[model samples]
Target: MRGVFLLLGLVGLCNASVLTVNDEIHMRSKRSSESEMTRIRNMSPSDRPNCQPGVTPPKIQVDTTERLSDLRNRFTAAGIHGYLVPSEDAHQSEYPSNYDLRREFISGMSGSAGRAVVLQNKAALWADGRYFLQAEDELDCHWILMKLGEEGVPTVTEWIEANLMDGQSFGVNTYLIKNVEWDEMSKDLAKKGITLKGVTPDLIDQIWTSGRPDQPNSPINALPLKYSGKSWQDKINNMHVAMAEKEADIMIVTGLDETAWLFNLRASDIDYNPFFLSYAIVNRAANTTILYIKSATSKLTASPTDAATTETVQQHLNTGASGSCSGRTGMCVTVKEYSNQQLQNDISSAVSTTTGYVWVSFGCSRAVYSSITAERVIQDNTPIALQKAQKNTVEQQGMRNSHIRDAVALIKFMAKLEKEVKEGKHWTEVKAAADLKKHRMAVKDNRGLSFSTIAGSGSNGAVIHYFPTNDTDKDITTSDMLLLDSGGQYLDGTTDVTRTFHFGTPTAYEKECYTRVLMGHVDFADVVIVGGTFGREIDSIARRPLWDVGLQYRHGTGHGIGMYLSVHEGPGRISLSHSSFISDEPLNEFQFFSDEPGYYEDGQFGIRLENIVMVKKATTKYQFPGTTFLTFETVTMVPYEPHLIVKELLSQQEVNWINAYHKTVQDTIGPLLADDALAASWLSARTKHMTLENETGSGNQQTAFLSLVAFAFVTHFIL
Candidate 1:
């Protein structure tokens, strides 16, 4: 998942000079204002550089004293005892722009997920297991690190209740709080006699006056019909059908990805995610659609590169020859400035026109929820999420095509890296990640990285979402376990894959752990589920193998992926979590998601194997009435590390599955790598037939040869 960061300048010590500290500060500020400040305000239509994952931003220092003091002053002025800073933007987006990173700025923790509370006397940051080590490395002593899900660590609400005094007000930005979150917290705090106030103009915003980046205002373009598979008009018609079924007169679309998908639009407002900041309103009774966006038509027309895109969108919406949708002859989308005032007025008007119910997702912001009458608003998961999760015919084909190309790039990188490490040529994790991206970019239809590359080596692999930064980079060695989790965004589709590799011989314990993880992955992929079964019902299949040995990983087994859209999609997931709305969605055909299971030993090594699998109809021996069977089609064509597997531990069924999958990999991706001999050889070596035989067999001999190669390299380095 993508996170947020602030673009503040790096604070460095100044040597002996004629300039005073104040003078130096003034000069640096002037320079920043002249260049960086101007660029932020006047952004071009082109996409900004992709974010560097794992690498700390310039502002990630071990000190937050000055910033905390400023925020405390604001809390005092607002007459609130404490303030809560969440990790979402006004749109409830998971991957917010750099401008909306108040939580990171005040707490000094940059992981994608976390919550922070600041009182005049004490401050604490709550992070989950994935970020515990990262939080320890980044946060200073001024803040207490509360590891979430730990036995003694309390949740954010529980912590607030324990810390705050009775009748004291705790402030939060209502625009950033989801309706469900606000409702639950308000009720919970009211029982404790604590006032949960909805504060305007966030307290952090008041204090972060300088050095904060400007809000994103990128160009909007239409996704081609070939890529989208369905027209925007057809998608809206489907929405109308769902709306009619729900008895909804008006529907509010607040999720950024939902809006982008609804209009067949794409933008670079947020990195990695091809989404723009906008709101949509759909009226089934009135046959009206409205899109609220910043500088709506002006920004689209300003860029010559977007001329065709603007025309396509205008025609697709039926705006007519006038190039606008004001009092048009046919039904069309009306574009308006994206502002809170304008949106609230429109919502009020829509609600006023409808005696029927207004539909909105429970994830909608409290600010939007407050404008509607309580009796008329119906809150549930948005219908568009389910519709998007199931891909159409064209999208399914594109996913397969793009993944083949993606495999070509990944296999090339793996082969080259393995060869280098065997020859004793050192490569840093950052450099290796860059080389992988170079290969991905050379492929056709590549847009950019789906997310920051997770290229962790040795001890770094224990960090689940480890990103290699200049400060934490490690050299690739034969003795280290390297975990590479990365993805690419193509014009056709989106992909996410994780593969763990060891260039040298592994201990028996390591081999056993890897085999168990592989067993889970194979089992989850091969199981046939009954129709209407929820994801949680089947999630344990991926973890049962590990659980048998009293070992389990901390993260979810899988999450939904979009086609050239958000990588971490929702309303469908495979996890043990009982609280999330997405966890309850039933397994359906045409749905694509990941199947990843792993085991990690803290400060030693980590092992995870992942592939994107598609849900499809399964042929069963017997069919019961009103019951349908479904299985998965693994689209990712990369081969697993052959040497890491303990073949004797696998059942014949599991062994057959591995052999079949490797054969498919060679058959599908083998021809594409014909031009690259080294990569072809590497693929052939790894994908060879596996058997539960003795160690002196042909497959084991090949493994021994590779080990000898690594040993020679290590011995040469020693000399």
Candidate 2:
């Protein structure tokens, strides 16, 4: 059996190596770069420490057929008809580490995106385009592979509808699923006469003993009040008030961010999401109990003493003579010390024994717990999510200040790139990317990059969500198009921006494509539809021009932006498809969305124009109307190649928008730049004025006239 498994593993490796010459060249070039070494070194010290004791890599033991048989047996014994396995945790991280490896453990597929549904007789795994090849190769042939986000492929909900029998129950681990997701699933299944079950026992851990790692218990350290701009007591008091309004006996907070925000704390327990593994229960009357691993103190203790001391003293100190702290009177306890499982059991027992109702807040973990019984957990946008989104006065000001600081660094980087590369000084994509990060770090209070920096040159830029790796040996040449999508996290706020440019004079096709993409971007920004849905808005604005030319991008036009949290936030977004699983559907007015539209030519180059827009209310006589109003804040400071912009392709409106946007960038960022950068900004700002005919042509002869007509038509109808 062992020999057979080894042979299969070797076969897979051999198959992976059967690549084209281009692939070999790309792979070899990537292996030779020093940037790759820098990336490995840059990871958290624990991931690759210098003096850590070496541990053997976990052995991969494949029991192909037996594993499936065992799962089927468990389903029968537990009275569960089926199980749903999602790829992400509470935070939808595309590339999750070992901590969130449930999907991989069950199906043996390692695609960054995918989900699985296991039934007694069969199973299926669903993935999107990027993972089709990888998923097919890694998953068992017998397990069905469903292509996701495409026509003809049923969604997980649709599949459940078809397979679930009346009165049948499906199991899911509550800790792994979010509240919004569970609510949608439960409502859909209920309509089909099927019940969604939350399995108390984590079946995945039982079957896969070797894959699960121990949960890290680092102490929760306080984020500076200057950064968070709120005291822990205030946040907790607010939660208590929200709980009272909802009439919930207790609000169960499961998401790490919610816990961190409530406690005014931060941790490196999870990458990107600065949160520790913890849970909390806040009663309507303001009483509270915290469930957390005991081991966290060691890590939390290492944080700055001033911040830690502030939190510890606040937690234990009495707020006043009333003998209560803030609005609530509560106690904090460790999960291991308090025994969460036992506490939950007691709550269940009390509910059944008494006639009173049980009210709890729902998130991914809490939602799963709600699914376990017949009790209905009222689902709503978490108080923390709402409070966090409507930034306080200080937070809003912080965001504005952060963008200005970030813009200065970006302007300098862009100016230097053009200067150095134009003089025949060659630079690799990796080096350019590193330079951007270094520049961002130079800002005072800048923590790090909000996400990975994408610096793609030429054909590589066309991979819309392209993340450059060391193996990406592409060079920034004078003839190539370049796309740099990046952002930074500061003590003040988070930022994300993308700018595509030409190193030198671009081809006619490139000019046309860039202009069309820009047109789509501006159209979306200028839209003033009242009560418009994102699905309808994106289809007509971003996709129309591309559709007219038989061109389109595979990705969404926009996604919701976070304050200083996740870059791709939710409850608000602009996309063609309706995602029922996320809360706060039908994005409210004043919400932020990225107005990005692009065209990708598989082997040549990609063009994208992105700007963040906020929904706002338009004033009118005897009425108040809402519309998607955009502000080209220019969080990203970079120059578009004037020589590559086909002025003839742009309408008068588009030309005006472009000129105005650049002017705003210059005005906002000019004073912050150093001497050399200020000079470069002056030069770049003037480039926007250059025209195809060296004259401002009449609207009748220019494309801007056509755009004006369209804009007028849209405004007339919407207003």
Candidate 3:
């Protein structure tokens, strides 16, 4: 078997014109024993992240005096009238490393989504509705807040054009901006005879020279074939086919997740994201592969010590060659230092030798796109993204299993929380969040959190992307609505689930809003679509219930979810806005997305129900030629809060759907909670069947009886 795989791997590299997929790579996962499960359940939480008080970033005001003066000096030296600062790294990552947080460092706006532009005299920040309140609180009086999506508010480009003169030049770090964004801005500015120059060294880095954090140099580890479900050799062969179809001689993988997925690797360079800062270049005709990283000589081990070494990673990649690809055996790789100079030199050599074009994603850095000849560059979405979005059979199963484990932890936390709140125990939002994290860390195969947990109480829940801090933490009381949006990154898959709870009685308005949101979520999950339907066309299905009441949320309805990778993947999303480039892509089978429909009242409370669902083929009575029907199969098994539901508002069909969904949750997660008596009782009560006639009754009246049954079972085991 080893020899057969070796031959197929060699064919992938040695003969790119006739590359073949290496299907001989074995993919399997080890099942956990009952003893292991019990041991993991009793594990300590002291070693986890959220269990302890987290360090907070200092409230350092954005110094317009020293920082702006220093940046303006650089602009003068670079011969530009203004400079643009984006909140993204060279990889266009959503959560960039501290070293690449130039926008936050310069503007003091730490929100993830925003753009900063600074001229000699004036500066401004552009942010969406989610961060309007946050941006106002963070940015100093020196900066103008340009609220995005508001009527009559100019866009970043329009604002730039309005500020600059015809003969002036505006500058940006080409290595930090997306290629498509750069193209659009350049063309728009050029019409007014304004120059948009590509600055080599970023101005913010120059200003932040004194106390800037160092770049990440974490360990780069291999993801086992059991978890990845595909060998890197097979993935590269698929890439070769994609390149051949595009008639490109070289393909550049710039996105961090793209590189990690292509190579079957994982790292912790970015917070909450299992990814490293890296780039890859594959020359098909030359049969050469090069991985660029900060420390090429560093040891490569399987994360958390799974017995993989540098040599194993090399073997898995079939990487072994001294210099040239003249007589390379398999997919030989050359590890090189990560720098723009080296990347440019290698791209020049590849373009000089081949007559074919160079394949690069439009999501790639503008600097990378500019390195190749304009006509020879094929700019589009990377094929790896589409491939990664569509999970394999192994990955799909892993997602299901991970969500079950996640549900066990969440149920335990909710049970304990409801008990404590009823007993008048004091709990802060931060403490409750930590308790949830502690429970999650005790689950088997758990790695870490997928993102920071959003634990908002009362009015804080109204803030869509709210994160509680020490200064802003509020007590989570029974009278308030608690919105918890959180996720975990397990070894097998990623899990993101959100549920709003009301320990006390909710008002009629609150119940109505929650039920409306629930209705939207159910509608979205139940809708069947044609094969080639775009997410934008059907996004209204999730918002119709809210729209009928003239209430809406500012954010998108759903986003693509990654498998043990980035929580936010790309190429497909469920959003109504046309501003997003990925919203138009067709949804495909095996693709996972968050079916989250929400409604937020600015001062009172917020209601959102989120479930990570997989797109699957739907059974239809009739089949159309050249088309397929699709529907959602929800993988998140956590039940909704019965206290906040208004049964009177639910239709018969909706009531039946909710009942069926709760039954599925109990059937799936009940066995896993056999040992945790408290969690088992909670799950049973939460999943109790509901009917329209039971509008005013408490659905969990049987909780006391279930708890007694669980206690008897535990006592029998003790005897």
Candidate 4:
């Protein structure tokens, strides 16, 4: 629900930047490294997921002509005229597994985001500006590369309108399309006499039976109440309260995070994310909550069902008891262990059995709705998201506690890198990432990394999401800037922190850039939002300093972060840009976000400073009566690298902010480490404030006494 970019909204019209160009367009690329694979292999067998979602597989050379020919056969067999393959899994995830790379499997374009439209006669693929260069490099001659967000380059819908004839049949897998999206597209297409067909048992799957990766059925781990901060029963109660307010009889939750949060469970089914695939349906009035998880989940714990009355899938399929929801006691917690198509069939039966109104969240797909026998479908965006986004006191404290451990791990890794580099020892990006991840996992209740460690060095740092492979990995050198943007998945909370450092003495320009970026980050972090300040309204504070210097970052200044859930969890964000995900709302208390602002000089270096902070009610002296004020509570306890910062550029106020934040980091993380350890020394040295020439006298002070006297004297003499 959070990660997937816009599918095909092609509006910001401009002259097209054709992909087939002589000049190489600078872009970000994600690569899986050798050390990472070794780490994966070294992990315990139980920890190994069937498919590593984060691992960037080698460039797949898909024969477009051959694949198109095969697809056309299926299209002919199914009597389908056209099909749309998006980079979407059944859950509509941002990064689907290799098993679900249907778009890449057919199109031969391997950008993280893109869509392919295939017709019997012609086929085309579309990518936004981010992948224009990549598309040119990866796309074969068989597919027409359409540059999205360009002038005269129509959106998928626009292309369909301009090209396709009336009375044509267009098909898509219903599971990959949300009900809302399908309804909108169907209505829009129907106007032109186009029939939108809902295809089941994916057409791609039909063609891709040869070497599809195994579906994940990883064992489920129960998230203890200490980590979760609430029992599943209590969470259910909260959902029921929202359901009552919505006046919906039944609520369907499909988002992975939503499901994971609803039912206190975690797994390694998806890479980086500790989540298991599942569906949750809760009835407000009936007080029944049905959790349909994999068979592997059943093996994780004893069947939470009465063995005497428990009906297996075989029994359900044989008889018409397809909707059996077996419970542990006389409670409403029904755990239906299933595999393969059982989840779909069981969900269909479960929702259809209800004669009352069915509430589907934003994440619910058209496939789920197609089989429903409910009287009505209510557009009920899951309230559990906002509920979970605003962490409770326990979760807040957990986050603070978790970051302390994470800070220690990071300090050790960074210190190790500094020592190695200073001693003229060679270190690679892969080694750096592996070493950091290793330290992270050694902490208490550490699952693994929150995401792939973004350990970029020198020119590599310029690539915002640059993940190193053996081929592209850079060696750590004194003359390069290392941007270590990494996080940990601790049981207490999730951690995301970025600190850019230069191993060698930085140039004047580099110091200025780093300080300016740091200034922007602190400015945004220190903002006290008064009277319903939406995140978008206050986004400029992070960019003003960068803008003043004619520099800007491509990505958003800040994004919402989840506690022990998704690193980029949403429903709210601190961004000026509007998308399908960013909803306009007041910045609420306990909501966390990574306050990061950066500058990137292509083929040179990138600098970004990020710290996760929780929103809290601001106790301001001056505020409009009857209005609320909000501020941020620093949660990420890591220290900033002082070497790269030009302290002379910082104002007294900025210097104070750094000193205060460093003190907090020291106070929180200092005790967590051993007394005689290298980490403690490193932390102390890293956080130690740089002494400016003067607190009262500094650069660019126009309102100085001399200036004021000169102005006054000049005016008096003139008079």
Candidate 5:
């Protein structure tokens, strides 16, 4: 039956000639035919043109360099020496594509990852590997194009330190930086004898003179209770219990993602981010309320039984149920009926009745926007952020399973690419990226990509954080090095991984940079810091090796990783500075952070090693005395390219860490691959014995050396 449906669906799609609900139905129907579906699925995504080629959106184009000059003048007039320009949407979302193209408007750098620092005398645009070629072509040559992660590129903080003179004040649009990033910037600048300012500047939109189009509210279809695994009442009750424990009488959910998760509804207002504009409140006594535009007919009580009932019964039931669930004594209110004034009055009245705390969930936009003071909403949401970061056993298990499946898909895609490239077939970066996306889509229960895939080759890789466009397309020659950083989302977990491989022989410089980055990656994973805040002077651990060689990536060493939500979720991060956008907010417990360290040589090549690390508290052991420890679980499964690794550059301990990590990946993912995928030559080639032993020190050997040797031998062979 499924095969028949798929056949019909494919036939309909081929004839339809245009996309519509019918087309979607046809596509979905074809989803069941594994063999037949594979044919359509094999089409290259890069070839489909999801985004237009060579046609820059007006919002993403810069008319002239005068725009930068105007920004500088505005900053000087406002008594600010520098203004931090971040690419963001009107909603101030982390997803840059959905936001207004601010960076592009000012500097003409079109990569998704970029920041412009407009100083009185100089303007600089910083970007990563994916944008190296694109940014150069689009951005004004006068603007310093600093490759991210390089020493000279300077982080936003480092820029402030070097450029801000004594008594010079730097300003950042507070909304642009998250509370955590803002706090770090503030503290770091303060230490350098510079004052950070949060002055509102309208010059950005003034010069651009355009606003994002209004996205109409669309109908949302709620998932069934069974699919959601919980009822509305049950979820509300659990939230009430949590509020009681926090000593908060009311819990306000501000983050749209959190609201969507709690309500079991999806919206298309934003691409990639499935959230509707809504607000939710739950009281400690189990009273729940939500405010949202009525975009869809309520089907809250619909069940399988209803579908089986007679037509007449269904019609009668639907008619009667429509008006029954309005704003009763304790029901959620439609946003239209409950005006802002009335809602504010209700909140004020509720607060006056109790001396209780307020619990605000993550990314509370409405709550923050409505606040008269800076700290009101931020303070209330801190605890909730911490709570959300700590994953439950079920979530962790889901993550582990997700990574295994994701790794398999990635390995398969890599094999396909190797075959194509080795056969003298010319492939574009866009095509390679599309192939990966196709493989990800093939996985059952997989949603779309968690983020855009970064497919860069050769000199393109030198851009620390690159976003590919058609104009920047590069042909994948067999002799080129490739850096593919990508991830996907499953219903159960989110995955992010980066692998740098040499299509052929690599230069000595490339090998050295890859080794350095790998060394830093290994160093960070072995760190056992306990009770340390992300910005509390702990960033040096990952940068120590790079710093020794006078090199670094301009981007943060690590960012908080989300679970089935924002690619960059927070309340926890690993960065150089302690202060973030919002001050006095506590870090989330058990939140995951990406451990990525990289080095880039402009017009040459770029290298980065990234893996998702989940924090876990370790019980204090009194074995030695006064030792506190914490452990991080490695969740990414893709293997590093051993052929490009200069093993001699790695310390014995670093080599041990790599071998142990690979063994873990093997153990976790080996059994899950299909026979054909498992038998692939690449998989077999990966199973070789990792070189663990090396020449011992001729002059001197310490106890640490013996311990490192013992660890390498034990971990290498154990798996």
Candidate 6:
């Protein structure tokens, strides 16, 4: 209820559509970014940061016993034996809006990804390893904790099958259950004589109706084609052309990124992710579309389409210099608020023209498909996800520009962190995260962080996806292996990167593991696209070094990143586990993904070095028939800590990769710091060439001081 999530929530009435491209706009987005950067530069750092360094908000007390009792009553009233609650929105997004966090509301377990299953007398919550420790502390006594992905851990489906009696009924909110999941669950439950029912008037919502936050009244606006590269018209044209090939009447874009790109619109409905919550339907036959969203009373117009009869719409596109929504085929997209009656009526009318069926994403919730009055619903395997992943010329350039600026901010954070620790001052985990956010906010066009900043120090770093809190705040020291994973959301691009740093001399084991992780990072990222390329294939390259050392992290090696969208986007990714979730598309030019290899030892240290890299044409000297290989070009600009490297352990190529990467970091960050002396000095010292002597240097305070001031004169003067 924080905001009407328009990202993947669409109630569409499309009259088939097609497109014709308009004149391309160049760098209007760049200009906008520059203007935003100028504004941030003009303001003080304290004035810009959205996240403040303070005590973590107290946890909201929810009575699980009372909630479970009430949910059971609702289940009985609906003639259901059990109900399943998942932490998801209508779209099966990893990060759901606050309004859709039903599982958290019911069970008091607050991880981003988790689910709760409740019956008359029994209830259990399933959380993966990342959330296991946190979940144990957060979940109440009544709920059984099922640690997913662990040995002997039964899947929720398997547990339901084994626990439920024959002929018993199972219920879940159809609006929340993804279509594919519903299909699988229904079939599984059906085989056991259990009826799977789609129950709504969700018990959780009913229990806390008055206390729920209201959705924001922010308007959805045009994202300016300069940033998008393609007009919404061009995007729709592309989709319609594909729609024609598939012989589908319409493609229902329920994913937030899909809808955002399709319309070239962005809004802050959810935190960090610059998107509004709305549903969109575009017709492949006629130039008509319908969007279920709110009215624009602020800066952004309500409806920017050609024309609309509805009074709810208050904004219109200027069609002049702006890369506005209405550009080609005279597409008039209707904008409206959420209304079940209106949506059903409009969708029914739209379905009347299409003969075959309505095109919905396979990932769409069953409730979305059931609302449409088509003869049948056909699932679209070819979704907008891939198109979004493969960046255009403009987007690729924008990514480079954004990350360069982002790199400066990150270096500033690390530099400040080092200065504080070296001065023998105490720095808490939350404080480090705040400093990072503060630095990112000072950069131009930064909307907010891409996600919650992870500044895990010592043992906290072992917990992947750990959110630092005042309760677990560790004092960052000179010797600890601090895993800092964070990213920024800029107008031009979204950036994700991580670095494990050490201020003092590292232990032998730490250095070995760090160097091995670094080797794996460089090795995997430097890998050429050989035969039968898949996520798991490259993932092994990152894990082999750690595997040899009899150590491994619990998480995936890498994941796809979005351009100013979700930090973790998909269609392609590199992960040993759950690779099938990503489409098996061959890695293509400009498709961005993370190259992160890590090592986490319980209660001792955690080392992870991550960089956002892109698949690009590898310069080939020797080639074989039927082979066109791609290589990753690292885009993240930040210096690696030299003291932790085991120089002898690294191959020459790995060492070269590190040095070249460090030079790029210095070259990229030095100029940004030319205007700030202290930060410039700090970055200059951190990125000095990595070598065996430096790696083996004695741990002396005097030597650390001279090394820290490696280039004092250069730091003071303009580059």
- lDDT values, one for every candidate: 0.76, 0.58, 0.74, 0.68, 0.58, 0.67
Instruction: Residues 1-719, candidate 4: write the lDDT tens digits.
Output: 11211211121110010011101111111222445434322322122121135644334334567777888899866767889887767765655566778988888776556778887766777765445544654565556666644543444554454455687888999988767667766776687688788887788888876767887776565666777888777888888787777677788777787888877667677777777777777887677777667773334343323222233322311211333445334344555664436656755766655666677766567777666676677754578878988998889999988988888888888877888889999899999999888989888868788877878898778766666667668898999888888998877788989999988899888898998899888877776665455555555567666776787665556667777887877666665444342234556888888888887787799888889899998887777778777788888888888877777767666778889999988887888777537778889987776566787635453233234323323332332
Write the residue-wise lDDT of candidate 3 on 1-719 in tens digits. 32322222211110000000111001111323545434333333232222235633225334455787788988778999999988888888877888888988888877777788887877877776566656765776567776654544455666666667789999999998877777767887887689999997787877797888899977777888788899888888888898899898888888898988998878888887888888889888887788887766443322334443334444455544322334557666676777878988888888888888788875778898888863677877777887999999999999999999998899989888988987899999899889888988888878789888888898888877777778669898889899999889887899889999999988999988999899888877877777766665566566666776788776667878888888877777765444322223678999998888887787688778999999999999999898788899999999998888877766666677789999999999998888889889988998999887765433342343234334423332332
How many residue pairs collide in each prediction? 1, 16, 0, 1, 25, 23
| Residue 657 in model 5: lDDT | 74
Q: Positional deviation of 43 in candidate 6, in angstroms? A: 56
What are the TM-scores, per candidate, against the unseen true structure?
0.87, 0.72, 0.85, 0.81, 0.69, 0.82
lDDT of 2 by residue, 340-389 (tens): 56446544543443222244433445433553342535556677766765
Of the candidates shown, which would achieve the greatest lDDT relative to the real structure? 1
Model 4 clashing residue pairs (backbone): 14-151
Candidate 3 residue 410 Cα shift, in angstroms, is 1.3
CA deviation > 4 Å runs, candidate 2: 1-83, 90-98, 104-112, 117-124, 128-145, 157-174, 178-219, 289-368, 371-376, 418-426, 470-473, 529-539, 586-591, 614-639, 675-687, 690-719
Please list the residue runs of candidate 4 whose C-alpha ends up more than 4 Å from where it truly belongs after superposition: 1-69, 80-82, 107-112, 119-153, 191-194, 296-330, 338-356, 373-376, 580-585, 675-677, 691-719
Candidate 6 shows a clash count of 23
> Rank by TM-score, descending?
1, 3, 6, 4, 2, 5
Segments of candidate 3 deviating more than 4 angstroms: 1-65, 300-311, 320-328, 580-584, 693-719
> Which candidate ranks first by TM-score, i.e. highest?
1
| lDDT (C-alpha) at residue 69 in model 4 | 82
lDDT per residue as tens, model 1, 1-719: 00100111111111110001111111111222334434432322122111223444333345788989998888767879889888788888777888898889899888777788887777887766667677777776667776644444445566666667788989999998877777777777776799889899888888888889999988777888888899888888898999888889899999898998888888888888888889989989788888888876674344424432435455556663333576677568877788888888999988887887799976788899998773777788777888888999999999999999999999999999999998999899999999999999898988888888889888888887778889788999999889899999887899899999999988888888989899889878987776776664555667666876799776667878889888877777775444421214777999998898887788888888889999999999999898788899999999998889988767666788899999999999999988999999999999999987653434543453344334423332332
Which model, 2 or 3, shows the larger lDDT? 3
lDDT of 2: 0.58
User: Residue 126 deviation, candidate 6, in Å?
Assistant: 2.1
RMSD of 2: 12.7
The pairs that clash in candidate 1 are: 54-467
Which of 2 and 5 is ahead in TM-score?
2
